[model samples]
Target: MSTTTKTNHIGRKISRIRELRGMKQETLAEVMGISQQSISHIENSETLEAEKLGKVAKALGVTKEGIENFSEENVINYFNNFNDNSFSNSQGTFNANNCTFNPLEKLMEVVEENKKLYERLLKAEQEKNIYLEKLLGK
Candidate 1:
């Protein structure tokens, strides 16, 4: 006979991923149209309803499976792999058949572009909040 151990704590996983992504409970609550206390309750539970989990996953900018399968060790491994020097040459370029490839440079360019996109998204969210506050003032 085999005993199955339930090791996946969905709520804690959600909280950890949220913190890793630099998101606060208040921000997640605003996106989910819930209260901060509600977010707190969700984070303390071992399991979540499928619908609410989906909502939380969406608000956190990750898929439900991502939250379910997240492991801190895996994230650390990914960072270590990313920082490995073997991926780059001494000149920071890849040499292949008389062609020099600098994929790291290209990756950095995309990362910069993504940063700009996130900044725009944050600005838009702030503007929307300001507009909502004005509506509340009326």
Candidate 2:
């Protein structure tokens, strides 16, 4: 199969969320008023008409766009555009030359070793502050 078809296959897999939510195929079929075989066919097929896709997305509580686009760029653009409001708070006093780590994002994780090492650095900072205060008689 073509790469586009393969991507659509991945979209089909997303339909499994209904089952993972403890919904039987028969249940979805009943709610949809369609046969279980039809639901199975839909979940197994890689391509669908726009109207059919909308029905499935509505039944699955997902946006139709979530299933239709097979392009990576399209997906990325959708997610970035979805968070357009997040970047509207750019009123801070930021000098381009003095700044680091632009393009704000979420923290992935911190390693346990890195955590312990940072604890030591924090202690060193406290000691330095104490020494500076003592020198100034504060």
Model 2, 4-113: lDDT tens digits are 53345733554555754588888878878899999988888877777887777787776777556445565455456444234222363322344355433323344556
Model 1 CA deviation exceeding 4 Å by range: 1-6, 84-138
Compared with the true structure, all predictions reach lDDT values of 0.86, 0.67
Q: Each model's TM-score, in the order given?
A: 0.57, 0.42
- Per-residue lDDT of 74-114 in model 1, one digit per residue for the tens? 78865665533333423564433453668899899999999
Score residue 29 of candidate 2 by CA lDDT. Answer: 84
* Index of the highest-lDDT prediction: 1
Candidate 2 accuracy as lDDT: 0.67
For residue 129, model 2's alpha carbon misses the true position, in angstroms, by 84
What does each candidate score in C-alpha RMSD?
Answer: 16.0, 15.6
Angstrom error at residue 125, model 1:
37
